[model samples]
Target: MDNHDLKEDPRLPYRATSRMEVVDVPTIAFLAATGEGDPNTSPLYADVVEALYASSYGVRAVAIEELGRKHTVAPLEGRWWADDLRVFSARDKDAWHWQMMIAQPPWVTVDVVTAGIERARSRRDLAEGGRVTFTTVTEGLAVQTLHVGPYDAEGPTIARMHDEFMPQHGYRPRGAHHEIYLSDARRTAPERLRTILRQPVEQSEPQS
Candidate 1:
């Protein structure tokens, strides 16, 4: 069976380095679920991840069997923020609010997602099954970089990106902090994990 890999697609900026770079991001669809708390220990976060992957793979199966098209399930992605954004700087993970998602190919529609959810439900019980929704996210202009290390060690890199890089480049944050998980934490060692960190941005106002 032929499989389409979105990660390798040139249209997406899945690649990044330790140095930040600006890029234009296009709109993309995803099967998403929102929750609050630390992903490391949150039961809701785990359920959301299970439901998202189940639905995503179910959609891929539908495409291959019913539509004669095949595609690989994309990596997990997330947008994170908090009621008090300072909580992030303070490393208060329990206070974090996040929308966890998996990118869906163009051919995967609402009907496909619905059918996939039903399929997943029949195969196994998914607590967040009904919560997953197909949605589009357009980040527009953004800056991104690759951080290769434990997630906990990302503070310094993120600090530089937000406090130093953006201002030096005439840009200001415009949206939630984003991350694309390229390596599975369960299987990859923390030091080797590759995560793409992105922040949507806009030109900063000129100083007086």
Candidate 2:
């Protein structure tokens, strides 16, 4: 083979675009703790995603599009509520798991998530097992921000969108406050981290 033939072009079939899109979606969701806040006792439900697809490795996912209606969260104190988002579950042959999720409904709250988990802890089936957890989610419309920075910095980006951008655009959060990390933090950098900050938003009033 000639030298030209020996040169293999490096290109991927799929190209990623650098842009953010707004969307509304209905989904079932799941919540997991990242050990960032208090564990087993903290009233914080931090991680949430739409449980869409599942496989041995994991599932493909996008930020939630919308947060839906509300329902009472049983097994929790003070009459908690949960949103109606779409969710799916899968268990790998090796018991490895992956979850693809939509955004949380506007009604889903941080308090509800941890409260649900604590309640699940009392359940015989959910406890005394491998990775047992309690989840709270709902379906509704959401606005997502694709941030290309360290996960730690995601808060500021979300703050800007919620505190400034969305309001400027005449939209307000209407769902559970949530986010998703597309990049592996173990090997990524603070400046090069790829994270998706998704927040459910709605117009102040019904649009005409």
Candidate 3:
């Protein structure tokens, strides 16, 4: 059987331009783990991400064995927020709360995820695996843009999205700031990395 690829799905937008655009996102499920702190320096972040990947691969293994099919594991994605929205513009990494996840194919249900977690626990140091859960997120109306460069350099683009674009377009931020890592940081140069920056939004009430 041919391996399924999430990137080919229209619901999953892997390619985007630097220009900001509006898109309607459908409800999607993910294997997710939530935590706080600087992703670059926090050990918790590292552990959670490892757990997500391990569980994802485990799910793929289970699928191949039980369903006789396989899928290309999607890229790592994140949802970020903080007590104060300004922290994002200030680049306060330590104050950030985040959920890192890997989107699974629709065929991978809750039972499959549970089985995957169990399998991963037996083979890896997934002290954080228990934190990983199958969750669905409905972004609905959202604005997104492709950000090219280092992770730290994304602040300006994000600011433009939240402070300028949203207001100009009569929308308000409604959910966590989201990011899709399209390039592997380990091998890609900081200047060449590509990321999709997204924010869920709602139409603003008309001024009195």
Candidate 2 residue runs with Cα over 4 Å from true position: 1-20, 29-136, 206-208
- Could you estimate the TM-score for every candidate? 0.97, 0.44, 0.97
Model 2 clash number: 30
Q: Which stretches of candidate 1 lie over 4 Å from their true place?
A: none
lDDT of 1 by residue, 1-208 (tens): 7788989889999888888999899999999999999999999999999999998888888888788889989999999997765565667899899999999888887888888878888898999888899899999999999999988888888888889999999999887999999999999999999999999999999999
Q: Would you list the clashing residue pairs of candidate 1? A: none
How does each model score on lDDT?
Answer: 0.90, 0.37, 0.90
Q: When superposed on Cα atoms, how far off is each prediction in RMSD?
A: 1.1, 16.2, 1.0
Candidate 3 has an lDDT of 0.90
lDDT value for model 2: 0.37
Residue-by-residue lDDT tens digits, candidate 2, 103-157: 2223445554444434434442332222323354443666665678754444456
> What is the Cα-based lDDT of residue 203 in candidate 2?
79
